[model samples]
Target: MSTTAERDPGKTQAWGAHAPTGLAGWVIRICHALPGTSRIWYRLTRLLRGPIKRAPVRPFDVNALGMELRLLNRGNFCEMTALYAPQFYDVPELDWLAAQLADGGTFVDIGGNIGLYSLAMAHRLGSRISIHTVEPDAELSARMRFNAEHNGLSINLAPVALSDHEGIATLKIDARQRGQNSLQDGTANGQADTREVPVNTLLALCQSRDITRIRAMKIDVEGHEPRILGHFFDNAPETLWPEALLIEHVHDDNRLMQRLIDALGYVEQGRTSRNLLLSRASTTGG
Candidate 1:
């Protein structure tokens, strides 16, 4: 994989030019220091979308989940939202997921994007745990690697999409919204740009890495969750199951995946705005 600096010299320069400094640095600090201010700043960003979009991609440095992260301010919604409101970006879900690894174990982040969840767990758990972040997008995966190396954190990155079968598949890329990229077929919506990414099942990934015990896992594979999780539940041994799971429920239809999880001995512990928090029945006293 090519380094970010090698792939885009201009982006490397933008990193220096857009470093959170002076007024921008002050605003970010204030947002972190004062509760609700981040939301206010987010609202302002929405109000000034035109100028913000027209400006070059900026970088914002902030302490999120106890880790100092340099987040990009354009293209990717996850990074942009985190840049604007680190304080409120999935705080409850992150807290709950982080708490599950208090004792120390492996954490897996599917569709990791820019490694927000994986990096946070690494920072919080330090050397006590291992992290595996899976992202197929070449650019996003490179950014994730850059962020991990930038922070001097160790994270195993798998640049492939996980599905029910092992093969090559088409991934729809929404350049403007990188997080919305998916493995589903057809471009009826006119999303012409697509990439062919390698696909593997969850069991294959865990087996290859010798990951027999997972403390927690967060999977956000757009709308392909059901296929992946269903295959894992059917093929993986009980010992290989994660104690806790944070599954993105926004893409689920009629709560189909939630019902499947329930049938597999996982109980819903809670629900965030975008994810359904679940724990193995034995672990959660369900």
Candidate 2:
């Protein structure tokens, strides 16, 4: 089977060359000709920025899978096309999430980035599900807030990095990759610029919100995923554990991560090259 990176060129490659300057571009041009859409089209073009990492960030919206997501695509070429013109989001994981989360179910998004997972869940599942999204970037968090409110979705936003410990930690950011920020020493130990951001363990987050019964969870915190999850699975009660999970597994540490989840009685259900989906052994598969 093809990897997620292979299935979606935009996921890892610069899409400016393969993108529909052909058919997709033609349809976008047609949309521009329609009344009241010209402005949006123009803004969308600005958002699909070039390969300059220092370029000004541009905020725009694009419909993907089933959600209309707000994005800041500029300055990151790979993320721009992937998030904006996305060939396809994580279909397998998304399918599992949709099948598992019933109305009134609870979902948690760690390292929410721009809250694409949250928006997609709310759009597909409606106001019945409560989504708690954790992200450390103030700007991206605000954009996520805008998308949730504009779409009339109920998403609780927490603007802090979820780590194994509480208090402040140095968050390392990729100058070129906005989604690659993390609290791991490998990512944070460099002389590359860092920021002291408040951190909280998943247990603390859930307790503060009185949130329990998490049906599903998605984690994508660069290299910090293992530590974040280690804290949860080791300490959180079985009731607080999610029945389904989507975690980015494209890391060197993921070999150990599998053992960690296995010890918690979770079984791997599916994979999408970039991520893995697991279902708890104690819970029935959706």
Candidate 3:
């Protein structure tokens, strides 16, 4: 087992507020002494991260030395074609989520990339809470399903797209890196052909499925969060709202996001590294 001392020197320096100078650092310096090793090291490190599995809990636990996470990714879903890396969003997001759990409620993960938090909820929390994971990418959806099975979990995976309405929509896929937030808007670099799918409002889908009492939600859809949020608010009952919302605030759209969330009647409650977690007023009559 690697102790904190034997671990990466950079992390040790970061924790101690000191400059790193050690055998590992010297080795790295020597490696960099060789021509082109620096860029090669950078590229290699960037290419593979981990589903670095730890002891199996309910949802799979992983520590890439980034953040401690309890979630699932397809065992086959290794990081390929660099793209946008999976950040530590799930760690704090899941911690906050653990705090917000209502005894037996539903948790919906819109734009669930690869079942990280969704699987965590199912594994850690169990059947007390229902889980609905929605991912548009077919490959990612497959991976999510695989991870679910790998963990013997029973999460509902919606492999279709979710939007304001039902219709044929062109899904702009960043084919080279499917995990990067691909959009329906035709602006992404490697968008593919239009695929039509039925779009259903969150409330409508919940009602149809007889779902009640939502505990929390995690939404990361690059820049389309505003639109998805708008539709949810438009259809949701004023009283029935998520206890917490962990959303990605990617661009410098603070004002825009505030306006949109305000339209939904959410006040900024808190923030994690790249996400905002909001809560409804407790005083509001449910």
Candidate 4:
């Protein structure tokens, strides 16, 4: 069949299952200590083994959040890069997102990738807060589910891709795709085995599901943020307005970002290195 690696729960290998930890786990923990050549050599060797026969159970137990995160080989390796090498994001932002705890609110994480922030929030916050995480990649979605369950949190996991519409679209897969927000370049030179999925707009989802209050929101849709933001503004009903928003602006299109903020009646709050934070206008017409 379809390899089933992404769908089989029994295949969800933990980091501790392999080494004293495991080879993958140790590779992740001591990755930073190794020299540049050694790091390259290690990753190449691991990659050649082909699609993680057994996933390493690297538990990124964020003590502050009271949750344990389980990552597969690919995710654990990326975590190493994010934690030690600091690619695409910084440490301060990671620390800030990890520290947040909600009493009883709605947190929507679009392009949540592998539950890095979603799991952290679910763990730190009380069980009252409802988490809605959407990820398109099957392999990553399966692992996200595993992490949520492992942490004893109930997140409404949607495996379908998110967009302004509800239909199928092609998804490019690149080995370099980092984080859950990873997407293929969407160009002719992209990688292979790229697939498509039915997409659902946030507005439609909220309208259909009766999502009234959005306490916090995070969007990391590669380069499709503008399209998503446009649709959100165009179709967002009166009842659904998020209090705080965090989105990645990888394109450097400041004008578009500003326009999106203005359309949504939100003012700039702050920036977390790579992402911009916006808050609902304190004095919107209401």
Candidate 5:
């Protein structure tokens, strides 16, 4: 049961050494100051892919949510967006989650891209709480390990995807945008590479950690949200459910999942631009 930090002992030291410099540093500072500039920078990078690809400084270090993040600006969309607009990145959702788990408990991050949410919670709650981050992407998981180590945070990292059934599943990797990588088929908008990743059920994951209750959980598994969540709610007991749930509902057009959550005694707290916030009625007095 070796931890992610234990497995990659040198990644933090190696990657954390590089920081943005010169023109890149200046541009990054501007983007951080004016969040809107991040979109312009992203578009410009997309337009001038050849030149940006050959740029010397690709990975830039930034302090985000009290954690030091070494972001790769070229392929990963999450890192690039956070690199510039860290302040505004999921501010509302993160705030809501923090408030919900203020007393300290287990927090699970499903489809954790580079451990932003998990790292943020770890930094905020400290050793009073346990954090578990599940990510199937090899590179992103490695980066997440580096980030946790660099920030001096302890988190349980599970490098496995969660689905309705347990086995190997095809994860479609969006080459141009790593954040768009998904387990759902035919969801890729651009050129996608596929890889076979190990899959497990959410209940099994919790059981493996001996977790009986969860304070909050954030799940952003692209289009595969319904499959994972539906199965979990159907099989898991109410005590095992998270008191607060932040689910990415951008791809859920029919809102079937919302109805399912409501039927399971979870009331909608609110909605952000990309996620729907829900809390259990018994726990939150909904």
Candidate 6:
């Protein structure tokens, strides 16, 4: 018999939880001093588990980095990162993204997942900055919504997948790791363990939302970064390209992605364990 981490409500081990480190870890300790109501919500979700078979949610609110965020214990990256103080999540990437953004600018998170990046950026840069978080997974999107509301943060939530084309696509959900879900064409199509999600090209989303300026963007779409960005490059108006970008670099198309970014005049500035920080040449001082 196979173990049931996916189907069992009692799965409790965060086998790969975040081991907070460095100066970021110190900041996490400082921000850990705030109060949250997630304790009540977690017990509530646990009571609902017997009826639902699997508890789809577990509330985790940690006040860190000057903001409070509601998180979900979903047996994925959230377990690995967001459960800890936000500072410990991705120190370098978090700092880089925050520094590149301005107070009144706009930011887009293509695979917003549980809204950690959105929370971090908004908290660090100030609430005046408009943020749009895009996450296609039904469960994760729900968590994103809950977190945003609990933190008293206002942000645009795009509950659809982003793709090279506009329309519907099957999102392949990982049975165990929630963060591993993907809408890429290379993934299995129309399988039983999938959900058909609405998708829109980047250009279409901006136009529909009446967004004219995108100051910075952080994209981590599992393995589909190339396709998402390919669509952006092909369709986005030149004047609308984000001045700063933080893209996941550990994908199959790393080389191709580098070439495409270079062609668009982006210069590699730094990198974290899972991402490459890039800034457009036009945005730099002459």
List pairs with backbone clashes in candidate 6: none
List pairs with backbone clashes in candidate 2: none
The model with the greater lDDT, 2 or 5, is 5
- The CA lDDT of each predicted structure is 0.77, 0.67, 0.55, 0.59, 0.77, 0.68
For candidate 1, give the lDDT of residue 134. Answer: 92
lDDT of 5 by residue, 173-253 (tens): 775677888785332344347777888999999999899999899999887887888789899997898888899878896
lDDT of 4 by residue, 1-286 (tens): 2334334534346633423234534544454344444346456444433433244322332112244444333333444343333222234454444333234678888887776777767766747678888888777777677767766777888777776667777676553443534433233243355766667788877766678888778888777777776788777764576776777766656466777576667877668646876667862222
What tens-digit string does per-residue lDDT give for candidate 6 at 139-195? Answer: 666656655665677778999899888888889877567788878454346477788
Give the deviation of candidate 6 from the true structure as CA RMSD: 9.4
> In model 3, which regions exceed 4 Å deviation?
1-89, 185-195, 252-256, 260-265, 283-286
State each candidate's clash count.
Answer: 0, 0, 2, 6, 0, 0
Model 1 misplaced stretches (Cα beyond 4 Å): 1-17, 21-30, 36-50, 60-64, 185-192
Off by over 4 Å in 2: 1-56, 76-79, 82-84, 184-192, 252-254
12-127: candidate 2 lDDT, tens digit per residue: 22223333344344543443343433346445544443332133443434555455554443534334644444443455677788888874688999888767778878888887
lDDT of model number 4: 0.59
lDDT measured at residue 210 in model 2 versus the true structure, 0 to 100: 95
Candidate 2 to truth, TM: 0.75
The runs of at least 3 residues in candidate 4 whose Cα sits more than 4 Å from the true structure, single-residue gaps closed, are 1-15, 19-66, 72-78, 82-91, 94-101, 178-191, 252-254, 283-286
Give per-residue CA lDDT, model 1, range 1-286, as digits (tens).
3334324423343234445666566655555555644466557555444444445655555566566566665778788767766666788788898788888999999999989999888877889889999998887787677667767889999998898899888888776788998896432354466888888899999999999999999999888888888889899998998899998888877465656565777888899778888898889842
Model 3 per-residue lDDT at 117: 73
